[model samples]
Target: MRSIAFLSADFLANPWPEYARFRAERPVWWADEIRMFCVFRHKDIRTCLTSTDYTVEYPFRVSRQVFGETLLDLDGPRHQRLRRPLAGLLLGQRDNIGFRAAAEDRARTAVAALRPDTELDMVRGPARTVPLTATATFLGIPPERHDWLLHTVEYLVSHLDGSSGDFARASALRAELEEYLLRLISTGAPARSMLGEVHSWVRDGRITAAEAVGLATLTLAAGFETSTGLISNALHCLARHPGHAAGAASDTGRLRSFLKETLRWEPPQHDTVRFARRDTTLAGVPVPAGSALKLVLASGNRDAEVFDHAEEFRPDRSTHGSLTFGHGSHSCLGTHIALDVAEAFIGALLARFPGLRAVDDPMPPITGSTFRRPQALRMWLGPKGES
Candidate 1:
């Protein structure tokens, strides 16, 4: 079997084949170039994520310098203390009927604005707009401030995959965003929003003012890019299999199954890095303390032993709860909201344009090593009045 380099551009473009080979031969191997142990199989990846020995703290110098110490860097009680309030808000928002209604309305408005028989980059149009609008709504920001929120979130996400020069600009943007959040908090909360809840936390002295800013930053950044990527990916899947679009619009159950399969087949966040808190063994391979381990989540989603005919994208296939959003203590807090936003946007798109289909053969390829999605998804919206 050929040795796999995780950082190779070729692997980034199409990693499934290489991941298959690795899962078959070497499920766990150390890559000298990157200096991180790569964990590939589904079972092992689950263990790596849930095991008490590993941590999500930044092991690399660059990430630590860039992101600073946020919730991702904490462990034990501190991690729970920081995470609980935010998790409560997110869960409440997801369960709130008012929030869901507003999200669906925004999604419909976004879809209705699109013109038919014209080439449209779905990523920029509905895919991007819907999530931004929903996030702004979640924060209780007025329409006038939506642009600022969008730009701030976009700048922060760009830095996640930025160069050295970009880091300086990103740092400036981070400061500005934190200040903006602080200002928003000063004005008082909107009666029915997450920002309001966070503001109350700050006032009660439960969380410091600085922690409030950090929590807001994490909420916006986490919800923005991942939600956008999931929407774009789901739409791309529907376009590839145009036959499914109609069923998705008419049947809620079928639509959900399609979305779940999409999550397993092409998750937005591909891989996550973790550090060994102490000298430990993973899959019987000894890893020294402070060493970095790259958990290939996309690879785990395709582990043949877990899913029957995993390589193929079958909407009806049973995923058995894939590790796309992760598991255990560090699992994503926004999983329910993310799925809701994606469902609303995709459902609106299908209902609005039942005959939607890809404009180009093979379409655009999904990219990015850390967060993955189509670079551009161009599709035709059938005729003017056919919907």
Candidate 2:
């Protein structure tokens, strides 16, 4: 870790230069400090993400240890069963209108918190809470646990770049979260909540108590954190390119393009960690069995072969098959959810404060390497003349 630039302040701030270097030189480089292989090129990253030769378990048991063997730690039929609930929700759940309306309404409510004629930080306001409450409601978690749940899961995922003490803290937080999920399962949640469906699965033996708990925790954490990142990134993008603001907030077609570009440009979910299931090779570099690897989706998203002017944010340039969320079996299930949440929140914000614009030109180059987002989305929320 000492020699690796990955944990350095500079790298966390701007890793693209180094990522580009890796893609050109050592496409499949190994980090001896952590004994993990990093796949940099978009092509190789695609294989690692889509191929069946990697597992999130084994060398990456931290996920299992913390989240208690959720779908992320499973494979094949087992993983499929646990994924059914989220996939169902993503597929509309036969109640698409109701679910989408609830999420949009929650988004509007979150944005409505900001005052009309003042400066504000979107990160602290709607960017965080919109997804937090929306995920909680969808999961059927009580409002009492929403705030606590957000911080707890934030710690859990943020520990990837922390010390052993940080890991210990994450473990402790995981215990508390696990306890909450289990208790809620034992008692009840709303019948329409995703948690309720998972709870029913536990009741009917479709999944075990432990699996159910893991499923719920993963749902809550992934749903909220991923959505928050996309929302913040979208807001940051909106601030940078004010010309697209009207379209992103008002027009669905333009809004989708803006988000697709945002996801490709500065995707919230950066990388996916995995372990080699068997001896293999990525970009001609040997990967022995049990080798820990990081499929850097952030780098893959910028591969010039796939995206023209990969470094720039061009809304007109389609980002159709980009590796924004992830690839393959364990890919994120919240794509539509994140986009919808961002659209709703951004739309509501502009509706409330019509002249909202960035106080700083670029909104502080999105901080954090693991879960990237603008530290503070400072904006003048008043009309142009008032501001």
List TM-score per model, in order: 0.94, 0.92
Per lDDT, the best of the predicted structures is: 1
State the TM-score for model 2: 0.92
Residues 261-334, model 2: lDDT tens digits: 99998988677788888999888899999898988898999999998899988998879669977878877887
The prediction achieving the highest TM-score against the true structure is 1
TM-score, cand. 1 vs. native: 0.94
Per-residue lDDT tens digits for candidate 1, residues 1-387, read: 577765678887899998888888889889887788999999988988888888887645454455555776677898899898787777764354255666787887887888876779888777777888887788777788888878767866776653435777778877887787887776755867777777778888888888887777777777788789889889888877767766787887889888888889999988877888899987788999988888999999998889988998998888775889888888888887788888887777777777778888988878777888988998888764444
* lDDT measured at residue 24 in model 1 versus the true structure, 0 to 100: 84
Give the clashing pairs for model 1. none
Q: What is the C-alpha RMSD of each candidate to the true structure, in Å?
A: 2.1, 2.8
Q: Which residue pairs come into collision in candidate 2?
A: none
Off by over 4 Å in 2: 1-4, 163-169, 384-387
